[model samples]
Target: MNKAVFPLLLLSFSSLFPAHGSGNETAALHRRYASAATEMHRVQVAMDAINAKLICRGCKIDVVDEIFSTDFRLKDQNSLGYDGKYSEAVYFDPPKDLNQTNAAPERALSYRGWYLAVKFDKNGELIDYYLTNIHK
Candidate 1:
């Protein structure tokens, strides 16, 4: 194999397997909603939500950006100190971002691993559990 092709081949091979994929780890989150994809691939060392359990449905929003993103917001190092492989970070408000998007979960939950976009009804009670993503 040519040296140049070798590097490309390596990249392709690496891509086949996610460096950090989902795992069997189970995390109990305090947040209302959660995403399977985020949890599935959250482990610093390969982990995924294929066989894990989280707050909301263990699901993935096809159009990720529509939900939550750090695109315009600056990233911060501070954390809520919540320890878990899965998070309940919601990011989108639906009306604006969901107007035009691909097939995804009913609601958007944690985007990536940190951000959470929460929504409340008339009352001020937490009411998003299992409502963020689709249930499998």
Candidate 2:
């Protein structure tokens, strides 16, 4: 009887301590998250570069006009039956080279048209702009 009981106890203890699977699933998930974060950061850097170039070229009237015009069109498309006119405003903040640390010139511009607002950083090249009318 004692021998039988001892064998059962040993079996229970061994079952309680299962073998490890080397954490393959956790490692895979971590790798995927890291890759996604890296991709996002790369995209942000590219955009920043584009914005800086646009700012360095000086503010052109055609570019500003096009951005505002597109904003108006989007607002009109999403407008209600009311007769209110949509307005677009552009804000520009140029990066200052005060300390001369050779930092890339920062060009931050935001265009708010109707209910849509678009923002670009210094490194973003002004290739395309998107606006959505979210006015209720």
- Candidate 1, residue 6: the lDDT equals 91
Residue-level lDDT tens digits of model 1 in 1-136: 5988999989989545423223223222211124434442233111122222221222232112122232312223342224312223343232234334557657444323332333222222223332233322
Those runs of model 2 whose alpha carbons end farther than 4 Å from true positions after fitting are 1-64, 67-70, 80-83, 94-136
Q: Which stretches of candidate 1 lie over 4 Å from their true place?
A: 21-91, 94-136
Assess every candidate by TM-score: 0.20, 0.17
Against the true structure, what is every candidate's RMSD? 17.3, 22.7
Residues 1-136 of candidate 2 have per-residue lDDT tens digits of 9999999999899655423222343343334433534434423332432243321222222333332233333343454234333334332222233454546576443433222233322322222343332333
Best by lDDT: 2
Highest TM-score: which candidate? 1
